[model samples]
Target: MMHSFGELVTKFTSYFNVRHFPMAPSTLYDPCEYFLGLGGKRIRPVMCLMGNELFDKITPDAYHVANAIELFHNFTLIHDDIMDKAPLRRGMQTVHTKFDEPTALLSGDVMMIQAYEYINKVRTNTIHRILTLFNKTAAQVCEGQQLDMDFEKKETVDLDDYIEMIGLKTSVLMAASLQLGAILGGAGDSNAKHLYEFGLNLGIAFQVQDDYLDAFGDPEKFGKQVGGDIVANKKTFLLIHALDVATGAQKEELQNLLKQNEDDKVEKVLAIYRSCGVDEWARSLKEKYVTVAFQHLEDIAVLSVRKKPLKELTSFLVQRDF
Candidate 1:
Protein backbone atom coordinates (compact mmCIF):
# COMPACT_ATOMS: atom_id res chain seq x y z
CA MET A 1 0.00 0.00 0.00
CA MET A 2 1.09 3.55 -0.66
CA HIS A 3 2.09 5.62 2.34
CA SER A 4 0.76 9.02 3.32
CA PHE A 5 3.09 12.01 2.89
CA GLY A 6 3.90 12.20 6.57
CA GLU A 7 4.66 8.49 6.77
CA LEU A 8 6.94 8.71 3.78
CA VAL A 9 8.81 11.59 5.34
CA THR A 10 9.21 9.72 8.59
CA LYS A 11 10.48 6.61 6.87
CA PHE A 12 12.97 8.57 4.79
CA THR A 13 14.20 10.44 7.82
CA SER A 14 14.71 7.30 9.86
CA TYR A 15 16.59 5.64 7.03
CA PHE A 16 18.73 8.72 6.54
CA ASN A 17 19.66 9.04 10.22
CA VAL A 18 21.20 5.59 10.44
CA ARG A 19 23.19 5.65 7.23
CA HIS A 20 26.94 5.40 7.86
CA PHE A 21 29.47 8.00 6.87
CA PRO A 22 33.26 7.95 7.10
CA MET A 23 34.60 8.58 10.59
CA ALA A 24 38.28 9.09 9.88
CA PRO A 25 38.16 12.84 9.24
CA SER A 26 36.07 14.38 12.02
CA THR A 27 36.04 17.94 10.64
CA LEU A 28 34.83 17.13 7.13
CA TYR A 29 32.21 14.56 8.09
CA ASP A 30 31.05 16.31 11.27
CA PRO A 31 29.79 19.38 9.43
CA CYS A 32 27.99 17.16 6.93
CA GLU A 33 26.34 15.35 9.80
CA TYR A 34 25.43 18.56 11.59
CA PHE A 35 24.04 20.18 8.49
CA LEU A 36 21.95 17.13 7.62
CA GLY A 37 20.81 16.85 11.19
CA LEU A 38 19.47 20.40 11.06
CA GLY A 39 16.35 18.82 9.60
CA GLY A 40 14.78 20.38 6.58
CA LYS A 41 11.38 19.24 5.29
CA ARG A 42 13.15 16.70 3.05
CA ILE A 43 10.69 17.50 0.27
CA ARG A 44 12.87 16.32 -2.61
CA PRO A 45 13.60 12.94 -1.12
CA VAL A 46 10.02 12.45 -0.04
CA MET A 47 8.85 13.30 -3.54
CA CYS A 48 11.36 10.85 -4.93
CA LEU A 49 10.03 8.07 -2.75
CA MET A 50 6.47 9.04 -3.65
CA GLY A 51 7.30 8.94 -7.33
CA ASN A 52 8.78 5.49 -6.94
CA GLU A 53 5.78 4.23 -5.01
CA LEU A 54 3.38 5.46 -7.67
CA PHE A 55 4.33 2.48 -9.84
CA ASP A 56 5.85 -0.09 -7.49
CA LYS A 57 6.89 -0.79 -3.94
CA ILE A 58 9.45 1.52 -2.30
CA THR A 59 12.55 -0.42 -3.20
CA PRO A 60 16.11 -0.07 -1.93
CA ASP A 61 16.87 1.65 -5.20
CA ALA A 62 14.38 4.36 -4.27
CA TYR A 63 16.13 4.86 -0.95
CA HIS A 64 19.47 5.20 -2.71
CA VAL A 65 18.16 7.81 -5.10
CA ALA A 66 16.40 9.66 -2.32
CA ASN A 67 19.57 9.70 -0.27
CA ALA A 68 21.51 11.07 -3.20
CA ILE A 69 18.93 13.77 -3.78
CA GLU A 70 18.98 14.82 -0.13
CA LEU A 71 22.75 14.89 -0.03
CA PHE A 72 22.95 16.97 -3.17
CA HIS A 73 20.29 19.34 -1.88
CA ASN A 74 22.26 19.98 1.32
CA PHE A 75 25.47 20.32 -0.65
CA THR A 76 23.91 23.09 -2.71
CA LEU A 77 22.57 24.76 0.42
CA ILE A 78 26.01 24.78 2.02
CA HIS A 79 27.58 26.47 -0.96
CA ASP A 80 24.60 28.74 -1.52
CA ASP A 81 24.71 29.99 2.07
CA ILE A 82 28.39 30.72 1.66
CA MET A 83 27.74 32.63 -1.55
CA ASP A 84 24.81 34.53 -0.06
CA LYS A 85 26.76 35.11 3.16
CA ALA A 86 23.69 33.87 4.95
CA PRO A 87 24.07 33.40 8.70
CA LEU A 88 21.26 30.99 9.42
CA ARG A 89 19.48 27.98 7.96
CA ARG A 90 16.55 26.11 9.52
CA GLY A 91 17.00 28.35 12.57
CA MET A 92 20.58 27.17 13.04
CA GLN A 93 23.94 28.48 12.00
CA THR A 94 24.82 27.84 8.36
CA VAL A 95 27.59 25.39 7.57
CA HIS A 96 30.01 28.12 6.54
CA THR A 97 29.13 30.18 9.58
CA LYS A 98 29.11 27.34 12.08
CA PHE A 99 32.36 26.02 10.76
CA ASP A 100 34.91 28.00 8.73
CA GLU A 101 34.42 28.81 5.05
CA PRO A 102 37.16 26.54 3.76
CA THR A 103 35.96 23.54 5.72
CA ALA A 104 32.39 24.21 4.68
CA LEU A 105 33.39 24.42 1.04
CA LEU A 106 35.35 21.17 1.20
CA SER A 107 32.52 19.48 3.06
CA GLY A 108 30.06 20.53 0.38
CA ASP A 109 32.34 19.12 -2.32
CA VAL A 110 32.60 15.81 -0.51
CA MET A 111 28.86 15.70 -0.14
CA MET A 112 28.49 16.01 -3.91
CA ILE A 113 30.83 13.09 -4.42
CA GLN A 114 28.95 11.09 -1.80
CA ALA A 115 25.68 11.84 -3.60
CA TYR A 116 27.08 10.08 -6.66
CA GLU A 117 28.12 7.16 -4.53
CA TYR A 118 24.47 6.64 -3.59
CA ILE A 119 23.41 7.15 -7.21
CA ASN A 120 25.76 4.36 -8.21
CA LYS A 121 23.87 2.03 -5.87
CA VAL A 122 20.71 2.07 -7.99
CA ARG A 123 21.48 -1.41 -9.38
CA THR A 124 19.25 -0.94 -12.37
CA ASN A 125 19.35 -1.21 -16.15
CA THR A 126 18.58 2.53 -16.36
CA ILE A 127 21.50 3.68 -14.21
CA HIS A 128 23.15 5.47 -17.11
CA ARG A 129 19.87 7.21 -17.96
CA ILE A 130 19.49 8.24 -14.33
CA LEU A 131 23.06 9.56 -14.17
CA THR A 132 22.55 11.49 -17.41
CA LEU A 133 19.49 13.22 -16.03
CA PHE A 134 21.21 13.82 -12.70
CA ASN A 135 24.33 15.32 -14.28
CA LYS A 136 22.30 17.59 -16.57
CA THR A 137 20.21 18.82 -13.65
CA ALA A 138 23.38 19.45 -11.63
CA ALA A 139 24.92 21.53 -14.42
CA GLN A 140 21.72 23.57 -14.90
CA VAL A 141 21.60 24.27 -11.14
CA CYS A 142 25.09 25.77 -11.35
CA GLU A 143 24.13 27.81 -14.39
CA GLY A 144 21.05 29.08 -12.59
CA GLN A 145 23.10 30.06 -9.53
CA GLN A 146 25.58 31.95 -11.71
CA LEU A 147 22.73 33.75 -13.47
CA ASP A 148 21.21 34.69 -10.11
CA MET A 149 24.53 36.16 -8.92
CA ASP A 150 24.88 38.02 -12.21
CA PHE A 151 21.39 39.50 -11.76
CA GLU A 152 22.42 41.14 -8.48
CA LYS A 153 24.97 43.18 -10.43
CA LYS A 154 22.73 44.05 -13.39
CA GLU A 155 20.52 47.14 -13.18
CA THR A 156 17.58 45.54 -14.95
CA VAL A 157 16.49 41.90 -15.08
CA ASP A 158 13.55 40.83 -17.19
CA LEU A 159 10.78 38.84 -15.49
CA ASP A 160 11.19 36.07 -18.02
CA ASP A 161 14.90 35.92 -17.28
CA TYR A 162 14.21 35.60 -13.57
CA ILE A 163 11.72 32.78 -14.17
CA GLU A 164 14.18 30.90 -16.35
CA MET A 165 16.95 31.31 -13.82
CA ILE A 166 14.83 29.94 -10.96
CA GLY A 167 13.52 27.16 -13.17
CA LEU A 168 17.02 26.01 -13.98
CA LYS A 169 18.50 26.54 -10.54
CA THR A 170 15.58 25.33 -8.48
CA SER A 171 12.96 23.46 -10.50
CA VAL A 172 15.06 21.08 -12.61
CA LEU A 173 16.36 19.10 -9.64
CA MET A 174 12.84 18.63 -8.37
CA ALA A 175 11.84 17.48 -11.85
CA ALA A 176 14.79 15.14 -11.97
CA SER A 177 14.00 13.75 -8.52
CA LEU A 178 10.58 12.63 -9.71
CA GLN A 179 11.93 11.33 -13.02
CA LEU A 180 14.70 9.44 -11.29
CA GLY A 181 12.28 7.81 -8.88
CA ALA A 182 9.82 6.96 -11.65
CA ILE A 183 12.52 5.40 -13.83
CA LEU A 184 13.78 3.21 -10.99
CA GLY A 185 10.26 2.09 -10.13
CA GLY A 186 9.77 0.65 -13.64
CA ALA A 187 7.53 3.43 -14.88
CA GLY A 188 7.17 4.03 -18.61
CA ASP A 189 8.93 6.91 -20.30
CA SER A 190 5.67 8.82 -20.79
CA ASN A 191 4.59 8.62 -17.13
CA ALA A 192 8.09 9.53 -16.01
CA LYS A 193 8.07 12.58 -18.25
CA HIS A 194 4.73 13.72 -16.91
CA LEU A 195 5.92 13.33 -13.32
CA TYR A 196 8.95 15.43 -14.22
CA GLU A 197 6.69 18.15 -15.55
CA PHE A 198 4.61 17.99 -12.39
CA GLY A 199 7.72 18.48 -10.29
CA LEU A 200 8.95 21.32 -12.50
CA ASN A 201 5.70 23.27 -12.18
CA LEU A 202 5.45 22.59 -8.48
CA GLY A 203 9.01 23.73 -7.92
CA ILE A 204 8.35 27.01 -9.70
CA ALA A 205 5.24 27.60 -7.65
CA PHE A 206 7.17 26.93 -4.44
CA GLN A 207 9.84 29.44 -5.42
CA VAL A 208 7.22 32.05 -6.23
CA GLN A 209 5.65 31.48 -2.85
CA ASP A 210 9.10 31.84 -1.30
CA ASP A 211 9.37 35.22 -3.00
CA TYR A 212 5.97 36.17 -1.64
CA LEU A 213 6.76 35.10 1.91
CA ASP A 214 9.99 37.04 1.87
CA ALA A 215 7.99 40.23 1.72
CA PHE A 216 4.62 39.61 3.33
CA GLY A 217 4.82 36.61 5.65
CA ASP A 218 4.62 37.07 9.39
CA PRO A 219 8.07 37.26 10.91
CA GLU A 220 7.27 34.70 13.63
CA LYS A 221 6.21 32.16 11.03
CA PHE A 222 8.71 33.01 8.30
CA GLY A 223 11.79 31.79 10.30
CA LYS A 224 13.94 34.64 8.94
CA GLN A 225 13.87 38.35 8.38
CA VAL A 226 10.69 39.19 6.52
CA GLY A 227 12.22 41.63 4.07
CA GLY A 228 15.61 39.97 3.61
CA ASP A 229 15.26 39.88 -0.14
CA ILE A 230 14.56 43.61 -0.13
CA VAL A 231 17.38 44.41 2.32
CA ALA A 232 19.90 42.48 0.19
CA ASN A 233 18.61 43.98 -3.09
CA LYS A 234 17.88 40.47 -4.31
CA LYS A 235 16.01 40.67 -7.64
CA THR A 236 12.85 38.94 -6.46
CA PHE A 237 9.62 38.87 -8.49
CA LEU A 238 8.13 41.73 -6.46
CA LEU A 239 11.19 43.93 -6.91
CA ILE A 240 11.44 43.08 -10.59
CA HIS A 241 7.77 43.83 -11.21
CA ALA A 242 7.96 47.02 -9.18
CA LEU A 243 10.90 48.10 -11.32
CA ASP A 244 9.05 47.28 -14.53
CA VAL A 245 5.82 49.10 -13.66
CA ALA A 246 6.83 52.02 -11.42
CA THR A 247 7.37 55.38 -13.14
CA GLY A 248 8.76 58.90 -12.45
CA ALA A 249 9.05 59.58 -8.71
CA GLN A 250 8.00 56.05 -7.82
CA LYS A 251 10.81 54.60 -9.91
CA GLU A 252 13.34 57.01 -8.47
CA GLU A 253 12.23 56.20 -4.96
CA LEU A 254 12.57 52.49 -5.64
CA GLN A 255 16.09 52.90 -7.02
CA ASN A 256 17.08 55.06 -4.08
CA LEU A 257 15.71 52.46 -1.64
CA LEU A 258 17.95 49.85 -3.25
CA LYS A 259 21.02 51.98 -2.57
CA GLN A 260 20.23 52.66 1.08
CA ASN A 261 21.23 50.53 4.12
CA GLU A 262 19.03 52.21 6.69
CA ASP A 263 16.88 50.36 9.27
CA ASP A 264 13.64 51.30 7.51
CA LYS A 265 14.83 50.12 4.09
CA VAL A 266 12.63 46.99 4.07
CA GLU A 267 9.56 48.96 5.04
CA LYS A 268 10.25 51.64 2.43
CA VAL A 269 10.74 49.08 -0.34
CA LEU A 270 7.63 47.15 0.65
CA ALA A 271 5.53 50.30 0.66
CA ILE A 272 6.67 50.95 -2.89
CA TYR A 273 5.90 47.32 -3.84
CA ARG A 274 2.39 47.59 -2.43
CA SER A 275 1.69 50.72 -4.44
CA CYS A 276 2.66 48.88 -7.65
CA GLY A 277 0.44 45.82 -6.92
CA VAL A 278 3.42 43.47 -7.26
CA ASP A 279 2.21 41.38 -4.30
CA GLU A 280 -1.11 40.68 -6.01
CA TRP A 281 0.67 39.86 -9.23
CA ALA A 282 2.94 37.43 -7.41
CA ARG A 283 -0.03 35.66 -5.81
CA SER A 284 -1.82 35.33 -9.14
CA LEU A 285 1.32 33.96 -10.79
CA LYS A 286 1.85 31.50 -7.93
CA GLU A 287 -1.72 30.23 -8.29
CA LYS A 288 -1.25 29.90 -12.04
CA TYR A 289 1.80 27.67 -11.60
CA VAL A 290 0.06 25.58 -8.95
CA THR A 291 -2.86 25.09 -11.35
CA VAL A 292 -0.46 24.02 -14.09
CA ALA A 293 1.28 21.63 -11.69
CA PHE A 294 -2.00 19.91 -10.84
CA GLN A 295 -2.74 19.61 -14.53
CA HIS A 296 0.53 17.78 -15.08
CA LEU A 297 -0.23 15.51 -12.14
CA GLU A 298 -3.63 14.80 -13.68
CA ASP A 299 -2.02 13.80 -16.97
CA ILE A 300 -0.19 10.96 -15.29
CA ALA A 301 -1.85 7.61 -16.10
CA VAL A 302 -2.64 6.36 -12.61
CA LEU A 303 -5.65 5.73 -10.47
CA SER A 304 -6.91 8.82 -8.68
CA VAL A 305 -6.20 7.16 -5.34
CA ARG A 306 -2.57 6.65 -6.27
CA LYS A 307 -2.38 10.38 -6.93
CA LYS A 308 -3.80 11.39 -3.54
CA PRO A 309 -0.52 11.71 -1.66
CA LEU A 310 0.96 13.94 -4.31
CA LYS A 311 -2.17 16.05 -4.41
CA GLU A 312 -2.06 16.45 -0.66
CA LEU A 313 1.64 17.26 -0.75
CA THR A 314 1.09 19.87 -3.45
CA SER A 315 -1.72 21.44 -1.48
CA PHE A 316 0.40 21.60 1.64
CA LEU A 317 3.24 23.22 -0.31
CA VAL A 318 1.25 25.88 -2.18
CA GLN A 319 -0.84 26.74 0.85
CA ARG A 320 2.01 26.98 3.36
CA ASP A 321 2.61 30.42 4.96
CA PHE A 322 6.21 29.77 5.96
Candidate 2:
Protein backbone atom coordinates (compact mmCIF):
# COMPACT_ATOMS: atom_id res chain seq x y z
CA MET A 1 0.00 0.00 0.00
CA MET A 2 1.18 3.51 -0.88
CA HIS A 3 1.88 5.72 2.11
CA SER A 4 0.67 9.31 2.06
CA PHE A 5 2.93 12.20 3.05
CA GLY A 6 1.32 12.41 6.48
CA GLU A 7 1.82 8.68 7.06
CA LEU A 8 5.48 8.88 6.10
CA VAL A 9 6.00 12.05 8.15
CA THR A 10 4.57 10.29 11.20
CA LYS A 11 6.66 7.22 10.50
CA PHE A 12 9.86 9.22 10.09
CA THR A 13 9.30 11.44 13.12
CA SER A 14 8.55 8.50 15.39
CA TYR A 15 11.80 6.92 14.29
CA PHE A 16 13.75 10.17 14.61
CA ASN A 17 12.55 11.09 18.08
CA VAL A 18 14.79 8.67 19.93
CA ARG A 19 17.78 8.64 22.24
CA HIS A 20 20.29 9.63 19.59
CA PHE A 21 23.21 10.39 21.85
CA PRO A 22 24.87 9.31 25.08
CA MET A 23 24.32 11.38 28.24
CA ALA A 24 27.82 12.08 29.45
CA PRO A 25 28.89 15.57 28.43
CA SER A 26 25.88 17.83 28.49
CA THR A 27 27.68 20.50 26.49
CA LEU A 28 27.70 18.96 23.01
CA TYR A 29 24.83 16.55 23.26
CA ASP A 30 22.54 19.00 24.98
CA PRO A 31 22.85 21.56 22.23
CA CYS A 32 22.30 18.83 19.65
CA GLU A 33 19.25 17.62 21.47
CA TYR A 34 17.90 21.13 21.91
CA PHE A 35 18.27 21.95 18.24
CA LEU A 36 16.61 18.72 17.16
CA GLY A 37 13.81 19.36 19.58
CA LEU A 38 13.12 22.59 17.75
CA GLY A 39 10.89 20.72 15.37
CA GLY A 40 10.54 21.56 11.68
CA LYS A 41 8.40 20.16 8.88
CA ARG A 42 11.09 17.51 8.18
CA ILE A 43 10.57 18.06 4.46
CA ARG A 44 13.84 16.68 3.10
CA PRO A 45 13.70 13.30 4.82
CA VAL A 46 10.02 12.89 3.99
CA MET A 47 10.82 13.76 0.39
CA CYS A 48 13.25 10.86 0.39
CA LEU A 49 10.53 8.53 1.54
CA MET A 50 8.18 9.94 -1.12
CA GLY A 51 10.85 9.42 -3.78
CA ASN A 52 11.27 5.82 -2.74
CA GLU A 53 7.54 5.17 -2.72
CA LEU A 54 7.04 6.77 -6.11
CA PHE A 55 8.79 3.99 -7.96
CA ASP A 56 8.33 1.01 -5.68
CA LYS A 57 7.73 0.04 -2.07
CA ILE A 58 9.76 1.90 0.50
CA THR A 59 12.86 -0.15 1.33
CA PRO A 60 14.90 -0.66 4.47
CA ASP A 61 17.67 1.33 2.84
CA ALA A 62 15.33 4.31 2.27
CA TYR A 63 14.63 4.72 6.00
CA HIS A 64 18.33 4.69 6.78
CA VAL A 65 19.03 7.25 4.08
CA ALA A 66 16.06 9.36 5.17
CA ASN A 67 17.46 9.41 8.69
CA ALA A 68 20.83 10.41 7.35
CA ILE A 69 19.31 13.21 5.28
CA GLU A 70 17.44 14.59 8.29
CA LEU A 71 20.57 14.54 10.43
CA PHE A 72 22.64 16.16 7.73
CA HIS A 73 19.99 18.82 7.17
CA ASN A 74 19.97 19.64 10.88
CA PHE A 75 23.74 19.69 10.93
CA THR A 76 23.71 22.43 8.33
CA LEU A 77 21.09 24.40 10.27
CA ILE A 78 23.17 24.30 13.45
CA HIS A 79 26.18 25.62 11.59
CA ASP A 80 24.12 28.11 9.61
CA ASP A 81 22.65 29.61 12.78
CA ILE A 82 26.14 29.95 14.18
CA MET A 83 27.48 31.46 11.00
CA ASP A 84 24.53 33.80 10.67
CA LYS A 85 24.95 34.48 14.40
CA ALA A 86 21.23 34.06 14.69
CA PRO A 87 20.18 34.20 18.32
CA LEU A 88 16.86 32.39 17.89
CA ARG A 89 15.53 29.40 16.06
CA ARG A 90 11.80 28.60 16.20
CA GLY A 91 11.59 31.18 19.02
CA MET A 92 14.22 29.35 21.08
CA GLN A 93 17.82 30.30 21.64
CA THR A 94 20.05 28.94 18.94
CA VAL A 95 22.71 26.36 19.65
CA HIS A 96 25.46 28.97 19.67
CA THR A 97 23.45 31.49 21.63
CA LYS A 98 22.33 29.04 24.31
CA PHE A 99 25.57 27.15 24.34
CA ASP A 100 29.04 28.37 23.38
CA GLU A 101 30.32 28.77 19.86
CA PRO A 102 32.90 26.06 20.20
CA THR A 103 30.30 23.71 21.61
CA ALA A 104 27.87 24.56 18.85
CA LEU A 105 30.53 23.90 16.22
CA LEU A 106 31.27 20.55 17.75
CA SER A 107 27.59 19.81 17.97
CA GLY A 108 27.26 20.40 14.26
CA ASP A 109 30.34 18.26 13.66
CA VAL A 110 29.05 15.32 15.69
CA MET A 111 25.66 15.49 14.04
CA MET A 112 27.32 15.25 10.62
CA ILE A 113 29.33 12.23 11.72
CA GLN A 114 26.17 10.64 13.08
CA ALA A 115 24.48 11.26 9.75
CA TYR A 116 27.19 9.20 8.12
CA GLU A 117 26.66 6.49 10.68
CA TYR A 118 23.06 6.28 9.55
CA ILE A 119 24.17 6.27 5.93
CA ASN A 120 26.39 3.30 6.62
CA LYS A 121 23.30 1.34 7.69
CA VAL A 122 21.92 1.24 4.16
CA ARG A 123 22.31 -1.89 2.03
CA THR A 124 25.83 -2.72 0.92
CA ASN A 125 24.99 -2.51 -2.78
CA THR A 126 23.71 1.08 -2.60
CA ILE A 127 26.15 2.37 0.03
CA HIS A 128 28.82 3.61 -2.34
CA ARG A 129 26.47 5.51 -4.64
CA ILE A 130 24.60 7.03 -1.69
CA LEU A 131 27.82 8.15 -0.05
CA THR A 132 29.10 9.70 -3.27
CA LEU A 133 25.92 11.68 -3.87
CA PHE A 134 25.57 12.72 -0.24
CA ASN A 135 29.19 13.82 -0.02
CA LYS A 136 29.07 15.80 -3.25
CA THR A 137 25.82 17.48 -2.21
CA ALA A 138 27.29 18.31 1.20
CA ALA A 139 30.29 19.99 -0.39
CA GLN A 140 28.07 21.92 -2.73
CA VAL A 141 25.98 23.14 0.20
CA CYS A 142 29.08 24.51 1.88
CA GLU A 143 30.17 26.12 -1.34
CA GLY A 144 26.74 27.67 -1.84
CA GLN A 145 26.79 29.06 1.70
CA GLN A 146 30.18 30.58 1.02
CA LEU A 147 28.82 32.19 -2.11
CA ASP A 148 25.90 33.61 -0.10
CA MET A 149 28.41 35.19 2.29
CA ASP A 150 30.52 36.42 -0.61
CA PHE A 151 27.48 37.92 -2.31
CA GLU A 152 26.75 40.00 0.76
CA LYS A 153 30.10 41.74 0.29
CA LYS A 154 29.82 42.57 -3.40
CA GLU A 155 28.22 45.84 -4.56
CA THR A 156 26.14 44.41 -7.40
CA VAL A 157 25.15 40.76 -7.93
CA ASP A 158 23.88 39.49 -11.25
CA LEU A 159 20.60 37.59 -11.38
CA ASP A 160 22.21 34.47 -12.78
CA ASP A 161 24.88 34.47 -10.05
CA TYR A 162 22.23 34.74 -7.32
CA ILE A 163 20.26 31.86 -8.87
CA GLU A 164 23.43 29.75 -9.02
CA MET A 165 24.16 30.43 -5.37
CA ILE A 166 20.65 29.45 -4.23
CA GLY A 167 20.73 26.37 -6.49
CA LEU A 168 23.86 25.19 -4.73
CA LYS A 169 22.86 26.26 -1.22
CA THR A 170 19.22 25.25 -1.13
CA SER A 171 18.43 23.08 -4.14
CA VAL A 172 21.19 20.43 -4.25
CA LEU A 173 20.32 18.69 -0.97
CA MET A 174 16.65 18.33 -1.88
CA ALA A 175 17.63 16.96 -5.27
CA ALA A 176 20.13 14.55 -3.75
CA SER A 177 17.67 13.45 -1.08
CA LEU A 178 15.07 12.48 -3.67
CA GLN A 179 17.62 10.88 -5.97
CA LEU A 180 19.12 8.86 -3.15
CA GLY A 181 15.70 7.50 -2.29
CA ALA A 182 15.00 6.75 -5.95
CA ILE A 183 18.18 4.74 -6.24
CA LEU A 184 17.41 2.76 -3.10
CA GLY A 185 13.93 2.00 -4.50
CA GLY A 186 15.48 0.29 -7.55
CA ALA A 187 14.91 3.10 -10.01
CA GLY A 188 17.13 3.24 -13.08
CA ASP A 189 19.63 6.07 -13.47
CA SER A 190 17.39 8.04 -15.86
CA ASN A 191 14.42 8.01 -13.53
CA ALA A 192 16.66 9.01 -10.65
CA LYS A 193 17.96 11.97 -12.66
CA HIS A 194 14.43 13.09 -13.49
CA LEU A 195 13.47 13.04 -9.82
CA TYR A 196 16.56 15.04 -9.02
CA GLU A 197 15.62 17.65 -11.59
CA PHE A 198 12.11 17.77 -10.17
CA GLY A 199 13.58 18.36 -6.73
CA LEU A 200 16.02 21.01 -7.94
CA ASN A 201 13.39 23.15 -9.60
CA LEU A 202 10.98 22.69 -6.73
CA GLY A 203 13.66 23.74 -4.28
CA ILE A 204 14.34 26.90 -6.24
CA ALA A 205 10.65 27.66 -6.27
CA PHE A 206 10.46 27.05 -2.54
CA GLN A 207 13.24 29.53 -1.93
CA VAL A 208 11.52 32.08 -4.09
CA GLN A 209 8.37 31.66 -2.09
CA ASP A 210 10.31 32.02 1.14
CA ASP A 211 12.04 35.14 -0.07
CA TYR A 212 8.74 36.62 -1.19
CA LEU A 213 7.13 35.92 2.14
CA ASP A 214 9.94 37.60 4.02
CA ALA A 215 9.00 40.86 2.31
CA PHE A 216 5.29 40.55 1.71
CA GLY A 217 3.86 38.17 4.29
CA ASP A 218 2.12 39.12 7.53
CA PRO A 219 4.41 39.00 10.53
CA GLU A 220 1.75 37.16 12.55
CA LYS A 221 1.32 34.40 10.00
CA PHE A 222 4.93 34.36 8.79
CA GLY A 223 6.29 33.84 12.30
CA LYS A 224 9.20 36.14 11.45
CA GLN A 225 9.52 39.87 11.20
CA VAL A 226 8.38 41.20 7.88
CA GLY A 227 11.11 42.97 5.91
CA GLY A 228 13.92 41.15 7.72
CA ASP A 229 15.65 40.56 4.43
CA ILE A 230 15.15 44.16 3.35
CA VAL A 231 16.47 45.62 6.61
CA ALA A 232 19.54 43.42 6.29
CA ASN A 233 20.05 44.30 2.62
CA LYS A 234 20.25 40.62 1.75
CA LYS A 235 20.21 40.11 -2.00
CA THR A 236 16.93 38.41 -2.85
CA PHE A 237 15.12 37.72 -6.11
CA LEU A 238 12.71 40.62 -5.60
CA LEU A 239 15.41 43.13 -4.69
CA ILE A 240 17.60 41.92 -7.54
CA HIS A 241 14.76 42.14 -10.01
CA ALA A 242 13.73 45.56 -8.71
CA LEU A 243 17.23 46.79 -9.35
CA ASP A 244 17.15 45.33 -12.83
CA VAL A 245 13.84 46.82 -13.88
CA ALA A 246 13.83 50.09 -11.94
CA THR A 247 15.01 53.31 -13.62
CA GLY A 248 15.67 57.08 -13.17
CA ALA A 249 14.76 58.47 -9.71
CA GLN A 250 13.50 55.05 -8.63
CA LYS A 251 16.81 53.48 -9.54
CA GLU A 252 18.79 56.17 -7.72
CA GLU A 253 16.56 55.86 -4.66
CA LEU A 254 16.89 52.10 -4.65
CA GLN A 255 20.67 52.38 -4.72
CA ASN A 256 20.62 54.82 -1.78
CA LEU A 257 18.32 52.63 0.29
CA LEU A 258 20.72 49.71 0.10
CA LYS A 259 23.43 51.74 1.83
CA GLN A 260 21.38 52.56 4.93
CA ASN A 261 19.70 50.58 7.75
CA GLU A 262 16.92 53.07 8.38
CA ASP A 263 13.47 52.35 9.82
CA ASP A 264 11.53 53.43 6.72
CA LYS A 265 13.90 51.38 4.57
CA VAL A 266 11.62 48.39 4.16
CA GLU A 267 8.60 50.46 3.27
CA LYS A 268 10.50 52.55 0.74
CA VAL A 269 12.15 49.53 -0.81
CA LEU A 270 8.92 47.58 -1.08
CA ALA A 271 7.27 50.61 -2.61
CA ILE A 272 9.98 50.65 -5.25
CA TYR A 273 9.48 46.91 -5.77
CA ARG A 274 5.79 47.46 -6.34
CA SER A 275 6.53 50.33 -8.71
CA CYS A 276 8.86 48.11 -10.70
CA GLY A 277 6.32 45.30 -10.62
CA VAL A 278 8.76 43.11 -8.66
CA ASP A 279 6.04 41.53 -6.53
CA GLU A 280 4.25 40.36 -9.63
CA TRP A 281 7.50 39.28 -11.21
CA ALA A 282 8.44 37.22 -8.13
CA ARG A 283 5.11 35.39 -8.25
CA SER A 284 5.64 34.50 -11.90
CA LEU A 285 9.26 33.55 -11.34
CA LYS A 286 8.20 31.14 -8.64
CA GLU A 287 5.51 29.81 -10.99
CA LYS A 288 8.09 29.44 -13.76
CA TYR A 289 10.28 27.24 -11.62
CA VAL A 290 7.26 25.36 -10.33
CA THR A 291 6.19 24.65 -13.89
CA VAL A 292 9.58 23.24 -14.74
CA ALA A 293 9.64 21.20 -11.56
CA PHE A 294 6.26 19.67 -12.40
CA GLN A 295 7.43 18.86 -15.92
CA HIS A 296 10.37 16.94 -14.54
CA LEU A 297 8.09 15.16 -12.15
CA GLU A 298 5.86 14.22 -15.07
CA ASP A 299 8.86 12.82 -16.90
CA ILE A 300 9.65 10.34 -14.13
CA ALA A 301 8.42 7.01 -15.52
CA VAL A 302 5.89 6.27 -12.80
CA LEU A 303 2.15 5.83 -12.69
CA SER A 304 0.24 9.10 -12.30
CA VAL A 305 -1.48 7.89 -9.13
CA ARG A 306 1.89 7.69 -7.38
CA LYS A 307 2.58 11.40 -8.02
CA LYS A 308 -0.33 12.96 -6.08
CA PRO A 309 1.57 13.64 -2.91
CA LEU A 310 4.47 15.32 -4.64
CA LYS A 311 2.12 17.53 -6.59
CA GLU A 312 0.33 18.43 -3.37
CA LEU A 313 3.66 19.13 -1.72
CA THR A 314 4.74 21.31 -4.63
CA SER A 315 1.50 23.27 -4.46
CA PHE A 316 1.84 23.74 -0.73
CA LEU A 317 5.44 24.86 -1.03
CA VAL A 318 4.63 27.54 -3.57
CA GLN A 319 1.23 28.64 -2.28
CA ARG A 320 1.77 28.99 1.46
CA ASP A 321 0.84 32.26 3.17
CA PHE A 322 3.30 31.65 5.99
* Tens-place lDDT digits, model 1, residues 6-62: 899889988888644698699889998889889888989999999999988988999
Per-residue lDDT tens digits for candidate 2, residues 1-322, read: 8987778888999988886777869877988888999988899999999999998898888988998999999999999998999998888899999888999999999999999999999865888999999999999999999999999888878999999999999999999988998988889988999999999999999999999999999899998899999998889998888888888899899999988988899999999999898989999999999999988988988899999888877877889998
| Candidate 2 residue runs with Cα over 4 Å from true position | none
**Per-residue lDDT of 305 in model 2:** 96
Give per-residue lDDT, candidate 1, residue 216.
Answer: 94
- Deviation in Å, model 1, residue 78 alpha carbon: 1.2
Q: After superposition, how far is residue 268 of candidate 1 from its true place, in Å?
A: 1.9
Reference-based lDDT, each prediction: 0.90, 0.91
lDDT of 2 at 114: 91
Clashing pairs in 1: none
Query: How much lDDT does candidate 2 score?
Result: 0.91
